[model samples]
Target: MKFQNIFVLFFAVSMFFSTQNIAAQSDEVVINEIMYKSLKAFDTNDWIELYNPSDADLNISGWLLKDDKDTRHFAFPANTIIKKRDFLVIIESKNKFTNVHPGIENYVGSFTFGFGTDDMVRIYNSNLQIVDSVNYKSKSPWYPETDSLGPSLELISHELDNSKAQSWRPSYVMHGTPGRPNSATHTEDEGIDDMLLNVFPNPAISSINIEFDTQVDGDLLIEVYDVLGNKVKTILENYMQSGYYNSYWDGLDESGNPTPTGIYFIKVKSPNGILNTKIVKSN
Candidate 1:
């Protein structure tokens, strides 16, 4: 009985130490590469690439990537996994790419300020723990953060480059746009003509302003509608100039009385097309 008791005690101690080693090993997190290319600063619509250099497959499900605001959380798919020595590219477009394996679909896409800017990209693991972060604040080669264009990430080197190897090759190339790049230089069929429509004071307390740009002279119609598709007011219905124009609308119905605090939609219809955005009103 004495020998049996000693054997059980040894086995228990061994199991405890083995579990501790496993736990310690699991905590070892490493990021291989974070690269991308951007045109201008403060452009968040650029393409970004992330590389996994280690031998272990990275389970990125439930992981979160955020910018400075942390308001926009880029969630990885529950089944998303970055294979060993592989890379993934994220584009800030709405088009869905379901065929590509490492191509993160539009669902996992995110926008960021471009290169040469002061911006931060942070990644959090499944436990809501910040695994890694990249800050471009003091970096001279990087772009400065501004309101107009966001930052961009570019991958410059590949696996063997770490060893100063001449034969090292970059695994992939990624690029992104700030606003829509001008398509006039390319064939008309290959490029898209973009129009700009913007609103100020998004979360407005009383009134909001709208603006747009167009080439042809036409009449502009601005309207406010509730989420239920009920038209509350028509702010404007008149001919405007070809260049940019601004108009304001107080948070009121047709009778000029204050509307209740709620969510509303502001739509601008011009000769170019229709642009709509949601606005919140607070008392």
Candidate 2:
């Protein structure tokens, strides 16, 4: 009779510890950002960013990443450790991604498969138990801009329930913030202007008009970059007062030669902040 009582108590204690361990594994690390759709102009490979918000280092070696149907699965290599409050990005193709935007150092893997516009992403522990999952979409309810050449879906906060669409927002930065803190997590300073830079007559035939407003006195630099991130032309560069200004680009390169018709990015730098907008040059 004493032996039976001892066995019951031991089983209850084991079950309690097992439940706690599972909870820790399921919530410590999470899928924080996703870029399943690339911009139309500067299209690049898709990616997923994982974040560890806990205070302790996590060894995720042998963990698995899978899509909704389990058709695509990627396993973390051995010795894979994510430092506390750090991020890790999984690239679909390193060559493709680096070709568009170079000098990105923090990341891992080249998952061969791509995610659907509306799909599921699940992470499982080494024991093959589900940890965290996100079912993201590209339509309304989800940020519509994330569906195409605008921004990637980013979790607003690590503490929020990432599985819900309401907890996500379109990344303020073009492309996406990978291997770094999410852009939505940062607080916007009211003192700085939003840098409402506008480009008119998009798909311009020969020349493009640029208008911007500044809130403070500072040097402003405006340049045009090609889809491959090459500097094609400098539209304007000078010190300007806090006021509205207009500039123009004549669809020409630095050498004064006519540039080919294609998609280009107009990057504006001012006292408040830097802003980027897309322009299409048509023949």
Consecutive 10-residue window with the lowest summed lDDT within model 2? 186-195
Give the TM-score comparing model 1 with the true structure, all chains together: 0.36
The residue ranges of model 1 lying beyond 4 angstroms of the native Cα positions read: 1-37, 40-44, 96-107, 110-116, 137-283
How well is each residue in 1-283 modelled by candidate 1, as lDDT tens digits? 9999999999999998754422222222332223333323222233445556566666677776766557766777666665555555544543322222234432346443333235566677778888655554423243221112222222233322221212221221112211222111121112113346677796789888887676667887889976445789999999877787778888889998888886676777777566566576876
**Each prediction's Cα lDDT score?**
0.52, 0.80
The alpha-carbon deviation from the true structure for residue 231 of candidate 2, after best TM-score superposition, in angstroms, is 1.4
Shift of residue 171 alpha carbon in model 1, Å: 12
**On residues 129-175, what C-alpha lDDT tens digit does candidate 2 reach at each position?**
89899998888688656777557789989889998888987776678
Off by over 4 Å in 2: 1-28, 32-47, 77-79, 91-120, 125-195, 203-206
Scored by Cα lDDT, where does model 2 land?
0.80
Against the true structure, what is each candidate's TM-score? 0.36, 0.60
